[model samples]
Target chain A: MSILLHDDTRVIVQGITGKIGSVQTKWMLQYGTKIVGGVTPGKGGQVVEGLPVFNYVEDAVKETGANASVFFVPAAFVLDAFFETIDAGIDFIVIVPEHIPVHDVMKMRDYADEKGITALGPTTPGILVPGKGKMGIMPASLFAPGRVGIISRSGTLSYEFAGILSEKQIGQSTVVGMGADPVVLCNLPKILAMFENDPDTDAVIIVGEVGGEQEEKAAEFIAGHMKKPVAAYIAGRFSPQGKKMGHAGAIVRGSAGTYEGKTGALREAGVTVLESPIHVHAWAEKYRLR
Target chain B: MRLHEYEGMDIFEKFGIPVPERGVAGTVDETLNIAEKTGYPAILKSQVLVGGRGLAGGIRPVQTPEECRTTAEALLETEIKGLPVREIMVCKKAVIERELYLGITIDGYSGRPVVVVSTEGGVHIEETARTSPDKIASFKIDPKFGFYPYQAVALLRRAGLDGKPLNACADILVRLYKVFRQYEAMIAEINPLAVLADGGLMAVDAVLEIDDSAMFRVKKMLSLSPEGRIGNRLERKGKEIGVTYVDLDGDIGLISSGAGLGMASMDIIGHGMEPANFLETGGGITADLLYKCMDLILMKPLRAVFINIYGGINPIHEGAKGIVRYIKDHGVTLPIVAKALGNHQEETWEILKSGGIHVVTEAATEKAVERLAALLNTSSPMSRS
Candidate 1:
């Protein structure tokens, strides 16, 4: 009942021969992600970590029924990799490469929207639906099957919150890394809506960095659609104002994407904002304990 | 990848847009030669990547060869936004009877590319927009049909341009689109498109930002990268130290993942610390990468080093190993601290413990800063042997 990845989602790794691809593939496999096959241009017939490698995504998808792809391709080739995956009918694509030119991101965003393929990020940590399939580079050990749905812009922060939830015997339905890119089309509110509708989910924890209208958008969504208790923590409180953050979309342009601004918005929308990352678990606990 | 005016003109010429005859000159002699060759009463513009050069006095009108030399010398000596002027652009000065602005760019806010035109041009467009919002006319360029010829024609006509100038403006608009499409430009601009006394149109100032993804097609564009534009002493030291640092106007110094982390780190800095420069070491932290990161942070004379890593499966241990290796290979002398969690945590800790680098690990951001503050308070900061 979780979002993005699930048990039956067979995944393919593009650029599987590259260092990052090879390393993450091993981890994904170790975590029991159904690594059906991989795609490497010239190294088609080679086998990597027991999984077969294909020359193209189409061949890999056809042969393995892999509907998802994790792109470990470099920035220069990311646009082509995205197009190739889309052309090959891959439904979901997680792009981990960061530092792509802004213009390239604009085109990639346009293309992804046009195709309706759930494009996660150019610098995202990927998605994880607990006790099921894992994609991107999220630490699988932090996640346990639970009812708390978590979504964040930072990868490690998600792990920290998830670990906190896990320690308290509270598992997660899903955790999404929305990336640092400005596009917040699939943000916390959207995920919250899905989690709220899911019978297995009881509460939601939104971990947001200061930047963009994403938190505001999520707050609006939560205000309207979300009936379940939502606990939230927005990072970058100590961050300097009017500074650009790590993500392309995370910059605090004027008042937008600021931690204070986001927290204010979330609070106005009836979200119980945590004072610190550690407080997220405490708030969730109080809601459960009550 | 924002292109300098010279690069923008090159694309403009290719698309048949009428820009003032211009050539980039690195020396006063070259400036004089270009001014003479292009004919006198020319404009010598400092070739820098940043804007506000006009206010900074980087743009000058040279009526004589002596004036060209003085202007070029003045420009080369001056620094605009931390970039020293190395080259000055010598361009033929047209009799600008009227100044109009024209630009085609992606409106990131709207999630679509748009064509912006204005009758008021010579001044900063942003300032003008805030002052006289009604003077600017903007039209969204649909990706399906792009900037239509009729839209361009109508836009110019509405902007108080008519007759030959309107036709010329339309032609330039069409050409600008070609340049934008050909080079995969994110922003193609011709500020103050002058209506000469003779009723002809000429672009006086241009700026183009090429899409980095399309670098494969424009391979030669790498040679014209802003790296050689205006390098500072700090940047040079950073380069020497093997870190990638950009001097920023903030108290907190950031060194993080190449683009995403770098950007996120900056936002985090702004959100958490103070206005700071973002130093992205791109990915794959080598001893060299860490050195570059540290050097960039030091170059800005940052008070603290905020090393935040969300290196998923990228292995924090490898990153920590790089940092430890950097310390062992080249001892650092600065107030540094970072937070790393995930992937190679155990192995990363092993490297830190075995290396004995005196690294601090805390879940609290305050503790991380406290450790950095404590290091800064030391009488003699640890010196690299």
Candidate 2:
């Protein structure tokens, strides 16, 4: 019932031989994710955590029919790693690497769009479908089985939002950290559309910050098509202007990227706007509380 | 990520786009020599990584070597639109029989790179778009096929460019598109593709912006000057803050991840709260840099400072070390509250173990909002002093 990921989705680790990759593989496997295979070019035929390692994504895909990739590649090798997944016809990719060059991001986006693949992040926390399968470094203890579907631009913010929802006994069907850098266009509106269409998700919690018109655009889309109750909190609402705080793309250019503009857009679209993060649960309940 | 006109034209020439014989001159003598070599009737343009140079008196036409000499001398030491004029470009000026504008840039609203063509040349295209939208023909290039020669030719023909000019414009357009993709440029523009009386195309003015993230690959892209494109008061404040500050026509100033948080902060301001500038301090936020950030925020005429952190590995303490050090060195002169989470909670707490600073502990971002709202009400003693 969740979007993009399910319990049956077989996962392959791209940098399985690395320290972080090995650790995360064990965590993901412990969470019941189907760790089908691993890839570490020169370390092919090696085994980590009892999982077989292959030299290439194609080899892994061919042997295990693994179509999803969780990449723990470093920034320098991220582009090549992504192409490997793309070449193997893997439709789903979650890139854990940060600080990838923006040009490579553009190339990745273009390539992904051309292939109609669903790729998340150059700085993402990966994707998670609660109680089913998980990829990324999100705290596992914070999640529970619930009807809320969450999407955010920050990994820490996602963790915070999940903890808030969990405190109210509100579990998430899926929590996707859409990354902040080389941010591919898995935007809020698109995620909202997916959440609205998903039978398991009853409500959607969207976390956004300043920079660009993505939030404003999401507000427009929410106004027109989002049938499910939507709650939003745009952080950095009180931030100063012209100083780059975080994320390369999180900039307010001209009249386009501002907190007021985004909030107004969301409010105009009938979205339950929570001015701060503390009010998310209350706002959600106000819209659909029992 | 934005390149000046000379830099863009360099890529244009590399890609075989027919650009005028030009050289960037950092001195008045060099400018005169370049103009002398290019013959009389040369153009001397100030090199700044921004638009609207003509309006800023950065672009000038020189009919004689004396004019070139004087203009270069005057401009080389001057500053335009906050960007210092380090060099002036001297190029062979074409006898423009006809003027046209052609460029390819990313249409952020559409999430695609677009080819923009206009019948009017050498003027601000924004004015043209406002006065007569139909005069400018735009096409959203499919990133897959991109801008092929035929597609570009068809687009130019639609814009009313005909005969050899149309074909030449098409060839230039294709090359420009290739340059855009090859350099991973955010923008590539030629203000006036002059139709020389001799039946040739000359790119009179050019500009390009390479994605900053791609700077690692573009080895030659050097930091030309410390003060660049300080567009406004806020930008000046950002300079005071000593961070990379790009002012938007908005009210909210953001502090987020280097790229993502910076962008998200702006969208929040633009879409949710008030409008503001976009600022990022992600990869290299040291203790000194934090002071600069604080100083920048405090100096600006802003309602509040929004601080958002998704600490990768630095932990809360490292961030706190920066903020606390900034506060101790410069003083908490402004109403600032931040939410920093992940990685090193204990270390972050250790750094923030101060009575003066307040850290929002709740996972719900609402805690941050309430704290900011409260801080906004209490006036800092520094404002009075």
Top lDDT hit: 2
TM-score of each: 0.82, 0.79
lDDT (Cα, tens digit) per residue for candidate 2, span B1-385:
5666776677778888888888878788888888889888888888776566778899888898777777787888787766678778888777888778877766554456778888876665566666666667778877766678999888887777778788778888999888878777766778788888998888877777667667677746443443444466666676555466766544444566444455434433343355355666644456667656756655556666667665542233555677778767765545555666655655665576562555676554445545665665532221110
What's the distance in Å from true for residue A49, model 2?
5.3
Docking verdict class for candidate 2? acceptable
- In model 2, how large is the Cα lDDT of residue B158? 78
True lDDT of residue B321, candidate 1: 67
Best candidate, TM-score: 1
Candidate 2, A149-267: lDDT as tens digits:
88887776777777777777778899998877524646566777889899998888887777667788888898899888888877665554542211112211334577788888888
* Alpha carbon deviation, residue B261, candidate 1 (Å): 5.4
CAPRI grade of model 1: acceptable
> DockQ scores for all the models shown?
0.26, 0.28
